[model samples]
Target: MPELPEVETFKQYFESTSLNKQIKNIKIKDTRILSIEENIFINTLRGKKFNSVTRHGKYLFVECNSFFLVMHFGMTGDLEYYRRGEEEPKYSKVLFEFTNNHILSYISTRMFGKLDITDDYKKYINKNRLGPDALTMSYEEFLMSLKRRTTNVKTALMNQRIICGIGNIYSDEILFRTQINPLTKINILQEYQLKELFTNIKEILKYGIRKKGNLATYSSKLIIPHRIEEENCPICHTPIKRYEILGRHGFFCPTCQKEN
Candidate 1:
């Protein structure tokens, strides 16, 4: 799944390549990936120019002259910008042809992504009950949300209603960096532990954005707990462990993140 960092990358790419281009036409190879009616979706975007792009959690919002286009990259969604006469991506489900003869294609291999149009982006976010964006959330706000949670700390980190943008992948990284066991109860966390967790959340997420969410490019000093089952802990040389937590697979260094 494309998390916050990946979605932010998409947003930046969309802004750089697709903005200011007048929509000349739209081709929908599959209507099932659209949230709105096929004709309505086509009409809503056919003539507008993308003025700006923003993201919240894993959703990308593209502002047009009169409306906003929202995109969710479910699991395998991506965007490709190509010039006229260039071959479109193999999984290109929707193609946006610009008056300048360029094309922006929304590619989704799994068909789980969605595209919709809305008049008010803020209203749409509020309607969906999304929490504050993970990257910009203040430390105070994080503590407040954590104080109200009774679940495992890892689960709390992944809860979109508490703090958006973090999914399973980043949650594992955050917990690993903090040296917190994934199954550790929220109430049992010490003050310093909480502080460390908060700091690591910000740092790790920023690093992710900088690396554009490519785990392979991450430093060996920073462990990638979930990338492989047979990997060893980079710090203590202990074998990395994996187990189910909160119905999702979690990976950690058992020696480093011992359950108390």
Candidate 2:
């Protein structure tokens, strides 16, 4: 799945390449990915100018002349930018051809991503009941977001309604960085601990972006998950431990990150 850093990278890439361009055509390979009717989606986008591309959490927001387009990359979804007459890759699922001959493709190995059209983004957000974005959230605000939750630390971090943009992979990485146990209860986090968590969250996110958001897997470089199963710890040189938390694989260094 594409997390916040990856989504932000796509947002930046689209903004730089496809912004302010008029849509010449749109090709929807799979109708199931459309939240609205296919004809309506094509009608709403054709000939309209793309004002900007923004991302809130994992949702990509494409601002057109009349409405916003929300994109959720459920799993194995990615974006590709190409120019005219170039062979569209085999994985290019949806193609948005621009007047300037630039082609923006939404490619997914699995068809889980969705595209939705809405005039009022606030209404859509409220309908979805998403919480504040993790990248923009403040330390105090993050604590407040978790104050009411009685779930385990892992569950709280993975809850999009509690704090957006964090998924299973990043949550595990964040806990490792903060030395917080993944099984810790949300309500038990102290003030100083909350501060530490907040700090580590931002730090790890920034680091991931700088590393091109490939903390999971990417075709390029293929180096990710600094602490995978049986891998050596980057921090303490101890053997990294792998366990199950929230039904997902969690990796950490027992010597470096002590559970309290």
Candidate 3:
């Protein structure tokens, strides 16, 4: 799934490659992922332009005045741009053609992603109860949210209702960096440790966006690379261990992140 960093990268990519041009046509090659009636969707966006775009948590909003197009990139959603006469990308669910003949494709291998339009994004957000974005949330707010949760630290951080944007993968990275065991109860954390956790959450998520959401570009100490290589810890050379948290798998250095 595309997390906050990946979605942020996609937002920048969209602005640079597909912004400002008037949309000439809307094509939905796959009806499986449609959130609205095809005709309604086509009628709403075919002639209008995407005035601006923004991201909240893992969702992307393409705005045109009060109307907003919300994209939930489930599992494998992505964006691609190309000119006419070139081969269209494989697995492209929808295509947005501009008046200049350029195209933006919304591709998903699995049909999990959905594109829906709304007049008030605020209502939509509140209805779904998505918390403040991980990147923009204040440290005080984050601390307060976590302090209220009695769940394990990993579950607390990954809960979107508490603080959005972090999913399974980034939660592991944050806890590992903070040296907090995944199973650590939230109430057991000291004030200093909570502060450290908050700092690492912001720093790590920003670092991920800076690297364009490419795990290969991450620091050697990050567990992503270690998992990919099936190797020992980059910092301590301890064998990285994987344990199940809820339904997700978490990776940590046994020596570094002992149970609290």
lDDT of each: 0.87, 0.79, 0.86
User: For candidate 2, what is the TM-score?
Assistant: 0.91
Candidate 3, residues 1-260: lDDT per residue as tens digits?
48899999999989898777888999999987888898888888887788888888898889875688888888899999999889999999999999998999999989989999888887878888888889998987787677667899888888888888998888888988898888889988998998899899998899999998987778887877776335798778988888888887788888889887
How does model 3 fare in lDDT? 0.86
User: Which lDDT value does model 2 have at 159?
Assistant: 88
lDDT of 1 by residue, 1-260 (tens): 49898898888889889999899999999999999999998898888899999888888889997699999988899999999998889999999999999999999999999999999898888898887888888889888877767898888888888888898888888888899998999988999998898888889889999998887888887767335687888889888888887777778898999885
Residues 39-140 of candidate 2 have per-residue lDDT tens digits of 999999999888977677789878897699888888778888888888886766679998888899988778888888988777777788887788888876
Q: Model 1 misses residue 175 by how many Å?
A: 0.6
TM-score of 3: 0.95
lDDT of 1 at 169: 84
| TM-scores, one per candidate | 0.95, 0.91, 0.95
Candidate 1 wrong stretches, greater than 4 Å: none
lDDT of 2: 0.79
Question: What TM-score does prediction 1 earn?
Answer: 0.95
The lDDT leader among the candidates is 1
In candidate 2, which residue ranges exceed 4 Å CA deviation? 216-224
Q: Which ten residues in a row have the lowest lDDT in candidate 2?
A: 216-225
